[model samples]
Target: MMKNIILITLLAGFGFNLNAQPLAPDFTVTDSDGVEHQLYQDYLNQGKTVVIDLFFTYCPPCIALAPTLEDFYESWGGGTGDVEFIGLSIMNDDFNSDCAQFKIDHDVSYPMVGIDGGAIPAVQPYYSGDWGPFEGVPTFVVIHPDGTVDFDPSNGVYDGPGVTGLLEEAIRETGARKPYHLTGTVTMPGGNAIGSFDLNIEGELYSPGQMLPGGLFELDILLRPDSTYEISAVKSGSYNEGLTTFDMIKIRKHVLGIDNFQEPWKYLAADANSSGGISTADLIQLTKLVLAVSDNLPNNDPWGFIKTDYLFASPANPYEEAYQGDARTYMF
Candidate 1:
């Protein structure tokens, strides 16, 4: 009996793990549109080749590659000769809305579904490797028609040529094609060392996993220029505190008193409002200051130059204090 079993095993592929199934794991998830999708029944097991990517929108590299992913999906997704693409977002709490908005903003045409903790391990093969390690976001996995993984695009450096070449080969083999490009860098506010904070972009919050040797948080953003955007950072679940700190970054287009000053100040001269050569508006502003009725005054016109209470001592005289407590300085 032992000899017969050994012969059978040798005939079948001796080194193969007999208990290892060649089939991919099964799962079910709901898309952004509230539709339930079964992985094996509706996609893989039905003779379709699928590409699954695990990511969250707040991840900078993930956001940066979004356009490329969208372009690829549009070219070859959903019944395009047995090829399908899906994005799995792994965000918690408030990040859900942000991820949803990111999909819309980036014009991601494919379905982006949210997976709970129970479903995380079922998809681990796509992210984990035989070396007992896992690659984070922007990971890609190609599932073959026979239900086994044909190519794992994770663990490799994300570059345009390499990614495109591998994807092209996969396309030729599986008849699945999607136009994709790998670009962008992961960056955080305050020079990439955000202490222990997470950034929130378009409502999605991202925590910088573990502090590296440099004490920088894991918050990185991938972005393209000439695009309208807003980004903020928080201390994870402390939304209220995070919101306050995030809002403190005031963005203004004009300078107050100095041309190159970096610190905040409380005053500007009457002539400072003139951007396109002083006109009637400037005179009107001066008149309001003189009459102590200027609506734009920070805390009542202190100079009283408007009231002629103070006069210029010289043609090049520096601006005098407008009020008793006003210590405003000029920035030139």
Candidate 2:
């Protein structure tokens, strides 16, 4: 019983260690003007509070919240150092120029970005709930000035009193006092015209109809820099079913350190080969791998590939005695 308990505890610890979300990744996306924009370096880093809402132009709840979100933006978006509101329009087969026109007809004043292709994963996390099973429209997420997720609503419509109150609370917490420099462009895989599409970023929708051309087919967004973002595109038409492309994006303020750290190996390295942290026990395990005397090397090791491409030069020499001893000494 004690041995089983220890095994279970060790497994639980490993699982938790494996599930950490890496430091946010950054990305660059284009806007309606075909200009490139960086998420984190341009907007979030500029000291402006950001409110990102996701929606489809044709979605009833999204449309209903449009005017309300606009009203909030008018009230809070202007003036120096105030909250910045952005809408990301999830563009799919049903999203087109007509949908954009509908947004214009409704008088939405904020900028909207459109996603092209099937990049749903890019923006799924922003909507809250079980990301893999998101089932709500007009999901909202607020990013604090410091670039951490402040509010993420799972299931519900915006424009409700509760949502408004949450928005207000987010604004109070951000307390940003600087205007954001916004810019970005929309593009297709081959630079082909994205005939009538919507781009959803985070939880906001950017409809082309509200802009100059009846349906601004492509989009690019700019905001405070170093902000995390998700972008996706949807296109719809008669003969073809709707298609979407999703991608998670982060706009970085500076270059990041690149290291080839793979799992299992990294986990083992972290544990110094012992069941836990680096210690004398880990040294014993390292010796086993080195002498090919242990069954620790699984045939289909996920971490093995990662280690080969990153830390070590070859699979045959995955763990050198010197390297193992060094890692165990330092990591512990």
Candidate 3:
């Protein structure tokens, strides 16, 4: 009898001191119903406050905390409103059946995830101290929309409606707000749809240039409201893209001082070697690309985008100018 009691106590959770970081680690989990949830992408990035209950099935305190969480979950739109609730099992061996049984036993309506549902790895950062030390099971973590975490929202009170009020108060203290979205279209010259292009925001690679159906892109990721982002696009493939016999002839004429191009961008396009000016060397590279002798332009991308609002100090020689701003750029 004594041995069995000791085993049960060991199976429950061990106590730990609370010393967690303000920022929560992002994770992904699949619930018993097979619904996938990404901590940052799904909930926080969507401007939702998440209340996560980390517990095990056999624990008594965890059992006591379930009904209160259910009431709190329903009060906050039953996982459909600004607040989201997730029940995660800490036991590595607790599968979906164990979590489902726990949910049914307590009449819990929110998502309950177990090892089979990716709960263990999803909560590993908390217990592993990577995000900071955490308390024992039945711990409540309130994560605001901006990825801030309130590790002790319940403050040792987990049995009444007051606990729910505390959670709400913690959320408000974090000053959570909805996120803004950035949307735009990518196209080639003459308004033609680009096959694919890479997207960058604030010098970070956001998209790996996935193929868009009609070059329409929507960034619904974690974009903060009232924030400025330096967005840029890069599309480079097909060495002969926009290069032709006519281009070679034009460069030859410019080199010989026959017919000078008027636009600054035209000079930029003719600098195939990126040599800072138009010359016979550029005509040579353009000729190679047009004849399929080379598949890429040396020292220059096949296309580059410049903001339409850019100004050239030397209009006759636009290579002497440099402007940094928003614009759809491509190089031909």
Among these predictions, the greatest lDDT belongs to 3
- CA lDDT of 47 in candidate 3? 78
Compared with the true structure, what per-residue lDDT tens digits does model 2 show for residues 1-332?
Answer: 00000000000000001122232234354433344445577667776666666666677777776666676676564423456555555555433344346558778755455564222333555444332234566766566556665435423535566677666655655555422322222322222233444444465666544332322232323432334444333333321111111100000100121332232243333233333333334434434444446535222121111111133344233455224432211110
Residue-level lDDT tens digits of model 3 in 1-332: 00000000001010223344557888888998888999999988887888888888898888877787787666556766677889899997788888888888889889889998888887877776554457687777888787876676676776667677777667555454323234455554344565555656566676633444544565534433334455666665666765668777777888899999886667777777777788887787777777778777768776665544455667786664432322233211
Worst 10 residues of 3 by lDDT: 1-10
Clash count for candidate 1 is 9
Instruction: Mark the 10 consecutive residues where model 1 has the least summed lDDT.
Output: 1-10
All candidates in order of TM-score, best leading: 3, 1, 2
Tens digits of lDDT, candidate 1, 19-39? 334566677766676666677
Candidate 1, residue 46: Cα displacement in angstroms equals: 2.5
**C-alpha lDDT score of every prediction, in listed order:** 0.45, 0.42, 0.66
Task: Give the C-alpha lDDT of model 3.
Answer: 0.66
Measured on C-alpha atoms, candidate 1 has an lDDT of: 0.45
TM-score of each: 0.42, 0.40, 0.48
Top TM-score prediction, candidate number: 3
Clashes of each: 9, 67, 7
